[model samples]
Each structure stands twice: as C-alpha cells, then as structure tokens.
Target: MKKSVALMVGLRYTGAKKSNHFISFIALVSMIGIALGTIVLITVMSVMNGFQSELQERILGMVPHVVVGERGEGVHDWPEVEKQIVQHKDVIAAAPFIDTQAMFKARGNTRYGLVQGVLPEKEKKVSIISDYFIAGSLDNLKPKEFGIILGIGVARSLGVSMGDKVTLLIADGGTVSPAGFAPRQKRFTVVGIFEVRSEADSMITMIHMQDAAAFTRKGQLVSALRVTTNNVLDAQWTAYELRNQLDDKFYVSDWNYTHGTLFKAIKMEKTMMGVLLTLIVAVAAFNIITTLVMVVNDKQSDIAILRTLGASPATIMKIFIVQGSLNGFIGTILGVIGGVALAINLPQVVAFVEQLFGVNVIPGDVYFIGFLPSELHWDDVILITSVALSLTVLATLYPAWKASRTNPAEALRYE
Candidate 1:
C-alpha cells in the first residue's frame, strides 16, 4: 500500500501545476532535446547503411568475387578450370576472361583504362554488367568481329557512340619496329555502352574473348576464370578453399584483396559517426539531471509533509524516480516514431527538397549514386532508445536521493 501511494503521489506531482513555470519549461526542453537527438541519430545511421549497400551493389557487382589463374602467361585450360570451379557448392558461376591495360583513342581523344575480354553468354552468369547497359546488348560482342563495349565515362572521354570506330593501343606482345618496340594498335567498332555510376564506369571496357586472345597472341589462353559465390561476404573463405583444392601453380584471389580497404574505411566512418551522435543524447540526458535537481529544491515542503505522514526514504526516492522515468519514456516513444517515419521516406524527402530548391544534392558524376538512399534497421532504433533511457534513469538517482534525505523539521521550518 505504501508503494501504491508513492506511485500515485509521483504521478500527481508530475502533472500538477507548479509555482515555478520555469521548472516546467526546463523539463519540456529536456524532453525535446532527447527527441531531436534520437531522430537525427537514427536517420543518419540509416543513410550510412544505405551508402554501404550501394557500394556493395554498384562496385562489387562489376568486380568478380573470386578469380582463378595460373602463374604463367595465362590459364591454358580455362574451360576445365571453370568446370572444376562450378562443382564447388559455394560457387554460383564461373566465366573466362582476358584482362589487359590499353589506351583508347577516338575522335582525337585518348584515354587509358583496363580492357576486359569476356564471353558474353557465360559473362552474364558471373556479372551484372548486362543489367546496366545504356546502349547495345552484350550479345553484340561477337568473336573475330572486334566489337567493343565502353564504360560511360570512357565513352564520354573518347567522344564516341555506337557504331563509331575506336583505336586500342596495347603494349602486350608489341612488335619491334624501326622506332624500338611499338605497341600493337587495332581498330574496334563500338557496340555498347554501360554505366554503373561508380569508378568502374571510367576504368573498364569489354570485348570478345577470342579478339582478346588474338590481340595478345595467347591463342586459346585466358587471363583468368572469374567466379561468383552464393554469398559475397564469404568469398575469401571460398577462394582459400579453392586454392587448397587446385594445383600449386594456380592462384586464387577474391575481391577483398582489391577493395577490402575501401569497405573497411566506410565501416569505420559509420562507427565514428554513431559514437559522435550518441554524445548528443548524452548532453540531453544531462538536462534531465538539471530538471530533477530543481524539482527536488521546489518540493522540499511536500517531501517534509510526506515524511511526517510516515513515508519512508525508499518511498520518497521511488516517487521522483517514477516522475523522471516517465519523462524519458515519453520522449523515447516520440523519437522512435518520428525517426522511423523519416528514415523510411528519406530518399523521397531529399528529392522533394532538391526539387524545391532547384539543386542537385547528389551528382552521379561525383557520388556512386545520383539520389539519397536510406535503409532503417530496427536494431539501431532499439539501441538508441536503450541508451537514452539508461542515461535518463541514471540522472534521476542523485536528485531522488537528495529529496529522500530532506529533514522534516528543517524542510518545514518556514513553511
């Protein structure tokens, strides 16, 4: 019954009209601060998650998960190696490729990039390049015809489009001429263009595998067998296992070797941003301490009367704890609701803002994507709420203890 009375008194005091309107205002401010902090933290974390996903899809999609190659000139028996790789349970698909670095020239403009030769039919199973074609289909890359596909950035730099002729100058197996060694130059018709809105768009080009073999004078040899896995995150383990299974002369590599540093940096940035934003919630929690301290000072006479009526120190402490906890709970609830709604619609909101202001918030040429993205996870919301509530509860303890220690005679001496 004493506990019930404590609860009732706490509830009444929280909603009761106070003599000091400034106290009420301070409490309101504290609640608003918590809510604002939560909303910003949740929204920012969701957008960061979105950026991570975009990197995985746009960048990793073009880069193979795993690659198998021989230590010599190239993979001499690529078909047999591809067959063996497909037998692995974790391997989704394998495609032969010939990779080289070359300079592309068109309309008096020259650009340097990686030139990849692929079998169009098999390439589709191991890569997403087919999905991003802005011009002709991958089927246009027929053997011996020397048809080439240019990344959008390379296409723009060369000032060429479909059906235009481009010159490829390669140093591999270059012929010795009167001017020392000369690079092999060949003309190829532009058959397709693809854009992934990533660095790959500026640095990658594709042609028929047979054409690449002829250009490099490797006959039937391929540079490597690109492999796709069921799960991209497990590609390193899969590559390791494949290495153990293959001959010592063969080497296996995964995307982690090339792009791991980039992803790690992004993850670190996300963690730092999360920690920094959490400080905002902590600052708001400090306001709870200030509000509770003032409340203890204002309720000295009431506390004395309660003590005279036989209320124990424990009950007095519980009363203030209840009041402060209620404030935190209400703020947390409001923050979660507002934060979730905003995160789920963040892209649309950004688009609306850009439209209203006539400005491009995310430029395709600058960022991996041309629009804002958001991916809200319930776990982040739960964590932020837990941290906010814990801080608020801790803030209540000192002021509640001070209120409990008020002497009846001293507190009511001038009442």
Candidate 2:
C-alpha cells in the first residue's frame, strides 16, 4: 500500500475522478493569466523607468544644476563670487552668464529670443553646449567682440546662416539716446549655430560675455551664475547653503526648483501608471485563487483516501500547496524571461517595427533623443521579481488551507 501510495501521489498522476478534466484546464488558464499579467506589468514599468533615466541624463545635462541670481539686482562680483563658490566641497564648476530678453531681426523676420552670454573656453566644461555645435565652434566667440551663435530653429526662421550679420535689439537701462528713452540697438555676426532640441533651441542665441556686457552697456556684473554640482539631487540643499553663505540680496535656485512643476508631473505620472498596472497582476492572482479552490473541490476523494492512509494535515496542505505553487513558479519564470527580453531589446524592436512599417515613429526634436531610449536598471528588476514572488505565495494560502480541512469518511461516503 505504501508502494501504491507512492506510485499514486508521487510517481504516477493521482487525480480525484475521471470527470474533473475541466478543473485541470482551469488551472492552466490561471497559470497563463499570471504569466501574461506579470510580463506586461514588468515590461511597461521598465520602459517607463528607462525613459525617465534618459530624460535626466540628456535633457538635464544641457541645463546646469543650479543658477544663482536675483530678480532685479542680478549678480554682482560674479567672477570673484564664482571663484569663491567653486571652493565648496560639492561645487564642480561655475560659469558667469548674461541672460536677457531681446528681439532678433534678420531678413525682414523678427523673433523674440533669449540672449545668453558665455565665455568661450569655460562654458564647455559645465554644459554639453559644445556637443550641440553642429555648424560652428565656441572658439569663434571673441572677447569684447560681438559674435553670435544661433539655434537651428532660430536660424531657420530668420532665413540666415553662418557669417550673416543680424541686429539684436536690447532695452538699454531706460536711457535717452538723443531720442527720449528708446531701446538700444546693436549688430552681431552669426558665427555659430547649435541645436538643443528644446523650446530654447528655437529662440536662443549665445555671444561672448564681454561683448554682451559691452553691447548692453552693463558693467562687469552678470545676470546669473550657472553652477554645476557633483550630484544633482543635492542641488536644492546646495542652493540653500549658497543663499545662507551669501547675502540675502542674492538668491540661489536649483533645477528642481526651477522646473518643479514638470518634474512633479513626471513623478506623479509614473506613480499612477505603476498603480494601474499592478491591478492587472492582482486580477491574475485572483484567477490563481479560483484555480486552486476548484482543484481542492475536485480532489476531495483523493484527499479522503490520503487522510485515511494517515497523511498529516500539514502534508495535505503541502500537496495542494505544491499544486498551486507549481503554477506560480512556472508563470514567474516565464514572465521574468519575457519581461527582461522585452526590456533589453525594446529599442531594436522599435527600430525594426518602424522600418517594417516605413514610418518615423520617433521624431528627433519632439522626444529630445533621436530614438526611444531604454536603460534596464537591475535594482528595479530585482524589486519587481521579489514583489511578484511574494504575491504568488499569498495566492496559495486559502486554497491549501481548505484542502487540509476535508473530512475523510464524509468525503469518501459522498464519493
């Protein structure tokens, strides 16, 4: 009988009755549902995280971590102050900047633009501004000289190219220039062009720092200091430290503070998506519960036979537990394989699909990068795996307990 029991429960397949094939099929559905749901959830989350990582590294790379400036007073002692600020342990680099609103006129076209003044040599280290120089180099900027770099969009709109001079109309400090308090006008040579793939790309122009000071007739003072830090997340604290170390007249601001609304929106969106997708996995887990419960109901006679043969309740629980967990194990293994494969190969897959369809699904300017970016973080994958496994364990509890409580004589008599 022991040999028979081993053969029935261990070696050979032991099921409740001949009429319970539908129960087995239902279990298969439960397993497949789990696999599909887990696959979709992990794949979608990974892609979202990858997209966020690309935005931080690329778009934020173009902008500095922090900017120190005041509303009206601007910045004073900018060069000496920048030198002192860089002495901090967290400070990486600092560059003086002249940011002002101006109107650019070229070939009967007028566009409002943001005019920024930068030092030719120092600007490259802090920002990826040099990388965007598709047409000309920052070496073209001359000290105390008027040369300008046009963005790709700005140049296209104005119908101008390198070496074409354009007029920059700036508001001089409410001074009367023989014509009762009018705006000041200056001409700049368009020596370079850059493309940042943002709104600024359409309306930004860069000139030499000294030339900008001279053109605006402002003294050696600048409008701001673009400061780079070793860690961007610490920028807000560093900004506060800068404010306290310096005078109250000066203000310090970080990227998070400057683009607070946008970053907040991204965080909120990612969180909402996570919650929504997790619901699908939960529904799949419910299917697992139903499958296990039905298996318990169908196997009552086999369970009674086992109990009559001195099988312990814990052993009885283990039997159904094994059955339910077998389902979970297979689903999790397949889901992980499928999810990781999709995450790793998403970019190539997208390219292939686009080529096959003969369409440019990802536009360079709109999305910041030329293609869909993906970076599969191992830590995120581990967390997802751990959570999924825990949910699977929870999915087996009630059904296993129900199987353990069957009455041997009553179940056999009914059978």
Best by TM-score: 1
Give the number of the best model, judged by lDDT: 1
Instruction: Give each model a TM-score.
Output: 0.92, 0.83
Model 1, residue 159: distance off in Å is: 3.7
Record all residue pairs in model 1 with backbone atoms less than 3 Å apart, i.e. clashing: none
Q: Which lDDT tens digits does candidate 2 get at residues 225-284?
A: 898888877888888888788767777889986565666776788788777766676677
**Stretches of candidate 2 exceeding 4 Å from the true structure:** 1-25, 70-73, 104-111, 153-190, 196-200, 354-371
RMSD of 1: 2.2
- Angstrom error of the Cα, residue 45, model 2: value is 2.7
> What lDDT tens digits, residue by residue, belong to model 1 across residues 213-327?
9998889999999999999989999999999989999999999999989889889999999999889978887788888889999999999999999999999999998888778
